[model samples]
Target: MQRILLIDDDEQLGGPLASYFQRYELALTQAVKPSAGLALLREEHFDAAILDVMLPEMDGFELCRSIRKDNDIPIIMLTARGEVMDRVVGLELGADDYLPKPFEPRELVARLQSMLRRRSNSQVQDTQNELRFEGLSIDPARRSVTRQGEAVELTGTEFELLHMLASDSGRVFSRDDILNHLRGHEADLYSRAVDIVVSRLRKKLEPLDCIKTLRNAGYSLALRRLP
Candidate 1:
């Protein structure tokens, strides 16, 4: 069974979620605080973690970063607000995805399965192990990125976005296409979702002008620098 860590103050959310996930053979380990979640992470190895944005002391964003500090474990954040800004912030903080509260339990399970599928697919590719572009290197097996020989930490979603663009360098990817690649399908996402992720990604890949934003068209990878 796949072990999943769920960090949320709403104790009620745990019971139903746990029962629902059992259908998929996924086990849920619940934590009501950020500190407890962190401790659980240190004590056990979970396949993925789910965090709620509104937590005592440490918010989900901080908890997300705290987890990313040393582990590449996939993360999905739960939020009651469901605002575009909230999703943007969570994604910027390196969350693999987010689930709005009062959501259909089915949706959460689907996303969780999709997230796990993508993470598993990234490993053990037969064609190649790494994507090289100019001064950047992406190792899918390790889920790591390095620019100019310096390690660039990326979330699961960010790594997927970068890999999509770098794998097909110079190809324009419409917002829908990018969203489809990042998520399981082309969702009716707040258009800003793509922009925010791109903006955040740009900041991390600074001084290296590789990603290009085409007005009225889409985005593409244009690595001007040669490795």
Candidate 2:
């Protein structure tokens, strides 16, 4: 069973969601406060996390940032319905995905399943060779990236986006294309999310102009591959 941590202040939300998740082979653990949630994350092994925007102690964005500091666990942020800025900020903070509040339990399960599947697929396909560029080295099997001989910490989503571009260096991937590649579906908000992820990626890969924007076209890997 896949283990998931949910950090939300809704006192009554946890019990029902936990019961629903069980039917899909997901074990859900809940933390009503950010402190408790952070503690649980530090102490336990969870495959992914679900964080609500209106969390206690700190908001979900802050919690996500804190987690990204040391962990690469996939995170799904729950935002207020129709709150575009909330979703955008969550993605900017390194959330892998987001579901608006008052969501269907089935949809949440589907999202969790999709994330787990992607992680599994990446592990299987990325085991053989490491991709090397001028100043970047990507070990797919280890899911590690090094820039300029220094290890660069990246969220799961960031790593996946980098790996995708590296696999097809110089290919101009449109925002829609990137969103589809990373999340397996296209949504209106996802296009903007792609841009945010790319921006974050560029900063992490700083002083290395490896990703280039193509005006109205898309983005491409601009690095010279080391053979």
Candidate 3:
């Protein structure tokens, strides 16, 4: 059974959610306080975490930052506000995804499944083995991209974009689709931010010509070279 740690102050919602997830074959654990959640996290191993933004002792963002310091564990933030800034801040804070409150329980389940699926798929691909396309290479496990044998440093967003494009080479993904893939349940205000990340990625992959941008359409990776 997949272990999921849920941290939320709303006891009412948290109770039902725990029951709902338990029915779906997930071992659900709930922490009503941030401190308790942190304690559980340190003592136990969980596949993923569902965190609420507003907490009594300490905010979720602080908890998230603390978690990110040592754990790359996937995190899904729950926010009641649904503000764009809040979502962006969560993303920038290393949250894997965010879902606004007053949301369907089914939607939360779906998002959790998506996060797990992505992590599982990434692991199954042998990303630690390294991928080479012509002179370009990417090691997903190390989170490193290289061109012509030289290493290239990438931001988290840039690495994610590259991973998405590379995972399904030759598939045309729209900006909205890319944003959804990255943000999951989080609301994105600037869809054009996808283009910005792609541009930065393109610069890093300079002279490789692997990622091809389609004006007004989206992006597709060159499929013939890499393996």
Candidate 4:
């Protein structure tokens, strides 16, 4: 069973949700406070995390930021507001995905499964070669990146975006194309989602300047192959 952590103040939400998740072979652990959630994360292992935007001690964004400092765990934020800015902020803060409140249990489960599937697929590829560029390196099998011979820390989404562009360097990928590849679904909400990830990836790969953004076309890897 895949263990998942849920950090929401609604004590009532956890029990029923936990039972529902068991039907899909997922174990849900709940923490009503950010402190507790942070503690659980430090002490135990979870496949992913579900954080509520409205929480005690710190909001979901802060919690996401806190978690990113130490772990690259995939995070899905639950927000009642569902504003575009909220999604953008969460994505910028290193969340892998987000869902609005009052969502169907099935949909949440589907999102979780999709993320885990992508993660699993990346790990068991037939080809495990490192994609090397002028000053950057991407190891698909390890899901790791190196810039200028120094290891670069990337969230799951950021790494996937970088790898996607690196796989076909110089090929323009539309935002919709990138979205579908990352989320395994049609792009619906935030069009800037791809832009945010690209921006973050760009910052992380600083000094290399490998990712190039076309005026309106999309983004592509601009680095020359190191052979």
Instruction: Sort all candidates by TM-score, best to worst.
Output: 4, 2, 1, 3
Error of 4 at 95 (Å): 0.6
- TM-score quality measure for candidate 1: 0.91
What would you estimate as the lDDT of candidate 1? 0.84
Residue 138 of model 4 has an lDDT of 91
For model 1, name the residue pairs that clash. none
Task: After superposing candidate 1 on the true structure, give the runs of residues whose Cα lies further than 4 Å from its correct spot.
Answer: 224-227
TM-score of each candidate structure, all chains considered together: 0.91, 0.96, 0.69, 0.97
Off by over 4 Å in 4: 186-189
lDDT of each residue in 26-93, candidate 2, tens digit only: 99999999999999999999999999999778999999999998999999999999899998999998
Clashing pairs in 2: none
lDDT of 1 by residue, 108-139 (tens): 88888888887778776664567777788887
Encode model 3's per-residue lDDT on 1-227: one tens digit a residue.
Answer: 89999998878876778889977778788899988998999999999999889888989899888887666678888876647677667766767677888788888888778777766766566546766677877788877788788978665556677888877778999888897876564544456456566776787788878888788888998846554
Query: Native-vs-model 2 lDDT?
Result: 0.90
- Worst 10-residue lDDT window for candidate 2 reads 181-190
Cα lDDT over the full model 3: 0.77
Worst lDDT 10-window in candidate 1:
184-193
